[model samples]
Target: MQQPQDQTTTLQKTFRIILGVFMIAAAVGHLSFQRSEFQAQVPNWSPLSKDLTVILSGIVEAALGLGMVFWKKQRIKVGIALAIFYVLIFPGNIAQYLNHTNAFGLDTDAKRLARLFFQPVLILWAIWSTGALSHLTKKFKG
Candidate 1:
């Protein structure tokens, strides 16, 4: 019998697809109707201007989303890349909470603070859904 790669369950596949679609939708929001709201997440300390950073990141998100949806041959790498992307952008999320910039309906301090907790979940989603977490763990155990 041909051994299966990744060995991902049906649920994981579904989660991967859903996360890809979510990313694509978020890219649309970043580029189109919700630009300013996204800008609220950019840190002022960024060397790039907020709009430029937002647009560039949106372009990257679109590419990553497309990869996640179609690049079955390299799902693990894509997942790691996406998780890193989440890690890199996390500071902006923090800045949003600290700066108290209102956007994305996270208006109150409690709401903003709560939203901070979701970043790790996104990171895990990217890793777990793509099977990168298992892949990396196996490599380390070798």
Candidate 2:
């Protein structure tokens, strides 16, 4: 008989795959014609050139996206890593809102501020969709 945890894990795996595809699509936006749009999210205070930062982040996102989908044996590790990535990029989101820079249809301060609230959701999605929460819980409890 299949356990409840097994069903939950399967559901989480499916969600992880969906998140992986979303990341890959976003990475493509970062690297292609929308590159300049992505640059708007990079803080002016950043030491790196905007183009370089966008390209590097695009590459990293693509790798993480693929890893999340294909690296099942290491899914928990990938989930943790992706969560950290989301946290790291959150500053850029804040910079966009605070600096009044516009991109990806986030035209006004209200829209930008609203978007800021989604970052935590992405972080949680990464964790929950990969079963990383449960994995970490078990690791810490043992």
Which structure among the candidates has the greatest TM-score?
1
Q: TM-score, each model?
A: 0.95, 0.92
After superposition of all CA atoms, the RMSD between model 1 and the true structure is 2.7
User: What is candidate 1's CA lDDT for residue 141?
Assistant: 100
Decoy 1 TM-score against native: 0.95
Q: lDDT by residue for model 1 over 17-133, one digit each (tens)?
A: 899989999999989999999999999999999999999999989988988888877888888999999999999989999999999999998999999999999999998998888
**Candidate 2 residue lDDT tens string, 20-118:** 999899899999988999999999888999999999999999999998899876777788899999999999999999999989999999999999999
* Candidate topping lDDT: 1
Judged by whole-model lDDT over C-alpha atoms, candidate 2 comes out at: 0.88
